[model samples]
Target: MTTALLPPATDADLAVLREQLGRPARGVVGIAARCVCGNPTVVATSPRLPDGTPFPTFYYLTHPAATAAMSVLEADHVMRELADALAEDEDLQAAYLRAHESYLADRAAYGEVPEIEGISAGGMPTRVKCLHALAGHALAAGPGVNPIGDLALARSSWSPRRCVCAQPGAAG
Candidate 1:
């Protein structure tokens, strides 16, 4: 029997992802929701292309089973909503929604699910950073400082990882 090659999760790999997310990294900022399996799960929004298009989105990166089971569209829909909620400006929100719709249309025309890669949040991943950046920019554009922690979802199991590379007080 051939053995399947599974990507190994290592402490170093986690460190790299954490560094990419910046020092005080908020684990995965998930929206509280119920999975198709009826189990509660967190939905983390991944980044889009440079052109501001939402691509293959990952759900709970902590749970491989959920991530593997998520359909592209399902992930996209959740990401769209999360992004919209997190977006500081109307333009960004509109852009995210349009991109999502365009992706759906393209998927229907192609008759296959699109491949969403580089969407995992094993550490503080790039996608999460980008979302954080977007949220930050939006908050900066306004009068009141919309703190990242304010929008952060609080759940019993939701605990931000304290990365080895992280400075003291950086762990969110």
Candidate 2:
């Protein structure tokens, strides 16, 4: 089942996101998750862009601080550790498999692209490729959906419980 439909994004959100990433947003459909400060943390994007290219990444992390936190985890080689955990823990593997399924189901709700039919981001159900993707899934789906995402959230400096909005260079 689709967990929950995200709230429609406001023009304010688009401006903030553009400022956060230092570029314009493409194919954004809704705000998947938001920080305590009311800034969008994760955005749900269209499976296919206006350019007609199939974009597989559905949940996109957009907050500047959250992205920086995930980047720090990636730099620390956390993906390798999570991959190892996935390999050794059957329960974890099962849960991660479920996460993969959920991700795919979520994407399918919008539209399907044959090229990305079975693929899920962050090396899901098999490996931990990108913390940003996993973290996005975690934020959008909330805690307990993705174990790795939970772990990353727990271990990282960033927390949705806290607000890191409007930092030094974040756009208005």
Most TM-score-accurate candidate: 2
Residues 1-172, model 2: lDDT tens digits: 3556666789999998888888888988898888987888898988888899898889999988888999999999988888998999999999999999999888887788897888888889889999999999999987899899889989999888887576676533
Pairs with backbone N, CA or C atoms under 3 Å apart (clashes), candidate 2: none
Q: Name the lDDT of candidate 1.
A: 0.30
| Candidate 2 colliding pairs, count | 0
lDDT digits (tens) for residues 1-172 of candidate 1: 1112213323543443354344422322323223233222232333343454553433223222222223332344533544445465664444444433332332233223345432222112211233322232222222122222113222112222212223342221
Candidate 1 lDDT score at position 140:
20
Compute the lDDT for candidate 2: 0.87
Error of 1 at 55 (Å): 18
Error at 29, model 1, angstroms:
31
Candidate 2 has its poorest 10 consecutive residues by lDDT at 163-172
Each model's lDDT comes to 0.30, 0.87
**Residue-pair clashes per candidate, as listed?**
1, 0
